[model samples]
Target: MRQFPLEMHHMAPGRVVEWRLRSTAGAQSPGPDGADGTADRRASFNQDKHFTVAEESRAADDPTASWIAVTFEVAGPLDEDALTGSLLAFVRRHEVLRCEFRRLAGELACAPIPAAELALDTVPVADFDRTEELTRFLVERFKRSIDTLSWPLFTMGAVLREDSATVYLAFDHIVCDGMSMPIVVQEVERGYEALRRGELPDPAPAPSYLDFAEEQRSRYLSIDEHDERLGYWKEFMASGDGEFFPRFPLELGVEPGRMYSIVNEASPLLDAAEAEVFEKACLAVDGKPFMGVLAAVAVCLREAGGPGVYRGFMPVSERGRAGWGNSVGWFVNTMPIEFDASPGRDFEQVMASVRAGFGEMIGHLDVPFVRAWELLAPREFAARSWPYPVNFFSYIDMRKCPGAERHEDWRPTSHVWSAQANGACSWFQRDAEGLHMNSIYSDTPAARRTMDGFLEALRETVREIARHGSFRRPIALTPPRRPALTPLDVAAFARRG
Candidate 1:
């Protein structure tokens, strides 16, 4: 028998209940081929999906949790029974929610839990004064470590107050991504309305995540087609210098049992008018908005690090396949983006180069990053070091997605997990207010100042493009020498705090 650790914190002024999920289906014995008997009883994820499952399984105790959470504020009438029913219905509609990872023949495999054995815990709160405490409780609940070996790696609960109730939904990253949150919200809302009206919600026509995973596995297993792409990746990694990015000067020496704290700095990159001009400029160069922004980031890195090649990780969505766009699952694949911003190149030329590189990467998206790493790096070297990208970039435009609008006057907000382990990550969001960029970095003092300067440099680069319609002239670059911070600077910063 295998057991997984479970932790729950209940802060509301009510009784707390815990439910243990069990499979109602009978267990199967091993077959003649020596394969695990359950292999035939469970649905399987593709190679890429299994990669994430394996990763989470290894880091089961990691305090840096992998979860996606969304909060919804519902005002006016509150129907507790209807909401509970809706949530259960939502769970039954998605196959991924009923699945768990199990060890089969020395490998991790996913199998569905019987619906009759599924469990949901309820906590009734009566005090409005406990709002803050309840919020923290739910946040911790959402951020709590997940046991991937257990079925249904998701939780749904509500903190009911007199005037309003806040619905909190958390899903393990192994089963969902950022794009899946809105879909889940929509379904929950639809289910709630239908249940309130004494009717069952109509099922969506979207394909199951399991089907998508099976297709992905088949495509990735096609050795003849992927071998050529693997060759390209091996060559790409071989051509680059094997050195990691330079560290910030303020980074202290590694201390025993010390975890790196991540800090985020946000800045308004462009106003609505400036964003319009930036979009027009990108169109003039036959580039996309993200490409234009990436060009600016490359310039920032080149200026700071003294040019060579700036490589970063960019996540590519695999939902482009027909009928898979609406499926809720982990369908993102991270790929490396290398930019050569050598001195003496005009901004237009840089944009063209970036566009070309992006086109080439799109052509070879079938090759997974882990497979390429295994083929490219030596075994001994791989054991000693992690080949994570020095920088990461992600962009999201909520306006472009359907069913993302406010529902029934309820406000919805998404809280994404930070990619601090990657050292530096920049997320750009396009909203009604304007264009905003948030840079998350290691918490060293030097990293903070550098990120501040980096944001300023990014703004200046964009402004230059907007003003001149191109980067015909070279922009000023920061010197490679690290700046010395005096004691007075630290004292003053602390005083300001």
Candidate 2:
């Protein structure tokens, strides 16, 4: 480990005394007395500590880059000292924050480090005009690779402005998910507030991530109890046509040397009144905002693919269990949502089908996608095909979360790393402001066109819903008819022409 001499510099207003942080020694278990003479804290390293199958697959596919970033904008005079103390407290409360991963006997093992060893970095904001510089800094931060075997799987830093600052907590997806972000932020805020009042932050609720991990391992190892659920998935996979669902047809051929990139398209913000109407419409149909957005996607897919089954993946949280709601870890599992888009069916029918499919999937959510794939499909087939692109929909109402709304002004933003191999993925989040959607696809003209069309279709679907005020009845539609050409037919025609 590298050592550095202690140094002091002029402390900024309301700033904590800076400490020279030295790297901890190798992954050896700490002694009875921590480096600072504090009592040693150790978490067992076991097979249960290994990453989830989804996380393991993601890491194996792309280990060097991070796509998840949680940025918070805070307005008012900042207190660096209080913030540092709060962050340390927050880390100590969540074992996953102090945990790192290492390869042991052909498997990954987690090692927990003392929270005292973690440090926060503060970068001064020279001027408000340095927007480009700040963007570059954040981009570089997200692009930097995480050393899984190290003590920290995440990084925390602040871009300090005179009266306001932006605090960023970026992490590799392997350690956290979207649901975990708000919890982390809320805890940090509470910790900061407690420290500001010269009080120690309260202990986190029972059932930490380690506890959840053990429960997950136990459930996964004993599959006999979940035989019915497993059978349902196996049958579902087998019932599908031999061919995978079709990708959106691209007009132009992909360039030989083209690189992978993400293209994002979002609908205009729905104002308070407009959002109200949309919410009412959703409730009228026994659906939530997520169902509304998903219904729109289903409509678009029906229009794009035509008279066939459409398959996509949705990530559901397992935090509803007792003592698990507030736990910070990747307690999310991906489940398949299949909708049969018959040409004769109307929008209402399509939505009803979607709602029913979603309900059934949730009922059987205990079976992890990894295990389903292993039991239902061949290894070669799983490796060669990207069967389930994700459709992520979340509603984050900060008003309900304590401490989150205390700031004069704050906004949350997220980004995911994109790769060509991953294919197309869509995410939707509805907050107080409005609805925001981000879609990632390959950086090709054809890909862009397909995405643009899909967004247009989604907007049209939402407008129709609002116009009708309820999804109880089918919207206007023309007589059912087949497309002039399938994607394959179009490709053949393109080659011949």
Candidate 3:
């Protein structure tokens, strides 16, 4: 193996290089029984891609560092000369795209390694019959590819042009997250278009993902500021016992396997009315609608024959606070929330409890889920009982996808759903033509029916609350209750205050 420094290194502000692979040449060796065979590991980075720039900076907050990998591909009978010229030009224009990673001490980091720049090598095969073989070969090479610094992860493949032939590029996910793919893809398109048109690609002045990662480090690293927050989680997790409400009847560990079923239905209500109802319920509970919705779902779970404990994980995006988002990186944190159930509480009272629980958790949103798990359980109980029970529930917040505006573009798509049960199920909500309450659980018909009935009962409960302040009949099994508070009492209290 050999590496080449970038001849056009100074074209960008960052370091860039081209890495080349040496050929077997006259070094062919004897294989088993003294017969000659090719070395399977022979590969040249120069043949497929190049890097314009790279950095050696380590993530101050995380042990991992970051790097960028860029590759070029050509299609059809193959325009070798055009592809070569285009790739060379691309490496010269963008410095960040050509970086590589290295280990610093015990932690991974990135360096301006001109030695690992992308390059192309000659493959003597031209038969189109090896198309599948070529694709598989490229994907396999990518699987072995690494950014060493950034999560030490790799991309599957980045396909450039697939007219008659296909080319792919891959990178580790540490320096990038799922959200960053669109920007990277768009830049690739721009680079290819510029090369095809015989012009220098315009340099885009966006900050790299590394910058965003550094920002995350600053916000989450303050121990003094975060201690109170951490302590809150410690207390919250310690609040519950080892018992968790399971979606399945058996203990969570007894699962044969999880099951998935699809539930699609149309609500007579228009989108506007549904939104109104949700907001109204929130207002009825003092205007924290997420709490209202979650409480409703909890009620449904209670009716669905749960393990008597309502708990699940919810992901909160920390991108918008002080220094996140805008740049592409993964900064999501999941918190475990438990809902205490009693027949004595009013639906609104339950909603208020959920609202307060989540509000407190968000104050400590910077803690990672792994760390939270550590703080929440006893050393012995941590491994056996779930940090939170398996019956997870989240509202479907898919409004990010354009609504009726792109209805014509949608085709009937089917997806496999799986929620591993520790003797529980995972449920999520999303807004479609109507409400979509998706349940993922063990592959049992009875459990599925139970969930369906639970959903029905939930809707019924919500409707009752919407029309009347309480259930038509008081919970018959509850202890005798004091007189319920009314809207007049609320209004008079507000007037007094």
Candidate 4:
């Protein structure tokens, strides 16, 4: 599924109802001793959560609340009661959904409610008459309602109609990421079907995200910047101008330390047939499809006057082991990477660089990103947003995800929303139809022009690779004029030769 803005989606008119989590015991603050009528078993915030809370804490009523959402359809009318049961069962299946973030002793803590006491109330909001009005309403509701400081950090709703219904759910980034979208759809659908049959959905027990966070802290919490495991990160920062975050080479017209509204766009790059051919071409060069795509992106940037040495960070999945794949939470580790995209390099050579760069990055995943930021850039770490524009790239192949086979009928789509940004992030998703690139960047005249040109070049470069087994950087037919050389300069050059 492609990750795009929710406003771009077509909303059908129907009765809008929300299934929000309810509890008899409301949010409970910790006692003087850090106990809330229960055992002191609260899990410390993971690396991602630490960074998120720090950013949000910088400003009160921050508009850019981090959230990822999903929308899908169920055919042949809507079952209100069955759907309510499914929503409840789905939330209970994932322990993270039962969690609420609160401050205990000046630090963020996650406390989960008991499953037995958990309840879902289906509150009817409104019946939108037009899809246009409905779209606006959902966007505003999602932006205003899902706050990280609150207990119920997620919202679920369904649009009822005679022939079909559209279901959508949004969660704070503290509880979910892009990968969790498909799993949410699969579990909700399965639970709904089984409930309709008057039976229980006997899926495997999902591991708790709180447990995963605890394990992560046990392994990485003690390490500091002096630890030898951070040698890779140290060297990476040293390689640059001593900047922890790499800047996008192109100008984005964003002022330093200022955040602007985001412009979200998604477009197709190639169809299934062309994607297959592109994959075959990548295989011919002994590289994976992702590597090929990265190579193309690097080459495109260089051709657009970017530095020949590409430097950026990619979100590497921490769900490398069993049981954690099905568990929902932010299982991402941001790792830095750089590869040579110098002049005169062919696509195959760039792919080799990408392969080596990727391999080297994974070897040093022991250090968490939040720790590195705190050590390397303490001032910026304390801010609400990134210091400047940072280049970010993410890729996902949805064909391998659960419930992908029914994507044609379900028409599932994932969406991401943020109130503001200081940089550009491009996510490439491969589904059944084709390979598509979804981008969210600052809304500025310069940013729009730069990204437009970059996307155009990237599309052609990949298509050329698919057409042939290899691709070479196109050279200008007429080289620009050189400066006139003085007698002394010519002599110096001749003597060096």
Best by lDDT: 4
Q: Candidate 3 on 1-497: residue-level lDDT in tens? A: 00001110111111112222222222442332221232111101111111111131122221222223332223344344444444444332332333333333432233322212335443432222333444344434543445443322433222222342232234444444323333333344445556667765544433443444445444543444236656756555455444322233222223333223322221211233464566576687684545665776666555544434556666665556654333444445556676665456776777767877677667777666544444334352233234332555544333332222222222111111211232343333333333333344433454445544554566565555555644444322122332322211111211231
lDDT tens per residue, model 1, 1-497: 00001111222322222222334444542353222333322233333334444455357544344556665555545687777767766676676676666556654455645445444545543443553465455556655535344445776666565565556677777788777866777777777878888998755434667776666556654454246677656545555554332222223223323345666445567766787788789889888777888888887777776454656667787877567676777777667667676676777778888898788777878765554554445352243124332567777765554455553244444554532343566778654434667555667666666676677677878877777767655555543433532111111211231
Q: What's the TM-score of every candidate structure? A: 0.76, 0.76, 0.49, 0.91
Candidate 4 on 43-157: residue-level lDDT in tens? 5335345436535665565545667899888887888888888888888778778776665665556667766667888899999899789989988898888877676879999
**What overall lDDT, based on C-alpha atoms, would model 2 receive against the true structure?**
0.54
RMSD of 1: 8.2
Candidate 2 has its poorest 10 consecutive residues by lDDT at: 1-10
Instruction: List candidate 2 segments past 4 Å from native.
Output: 1-64, 116-129, 145-150, 222-227, 242-259, 264-269, 378-408, 419-421, 470-497
CA RMSD, predictions in order:
8.2, 10.8, 16.7, 10.7
The global C-alpha lDDT for each of the candidates, from Candidate 1 onward, is 0.58, 0.54, 0.39, 0.78
Q: Give the TM-score of candidate 3.
A: 0.49
Q: Is candidate 2 or 4 superior in TM-score?
A: 4
Model 1: residues with Cα > 4 Å off, grouped in runs: 1-64, 114-121, 125-135, 221-226, 242-259, 264-267, 306-308, 378-385, 405-410, 418-422, 463-468, 471-497
Q: Evaluate residue 74 in candidate 3 and report its C-alpha lDDT on the 0 to 100 scale.
A: 30
Weakest 10 consecutive residues of candidate 3 by summed lDDT: 1-10
Q: What is the lDDT of candidate 1?
A: 0.58
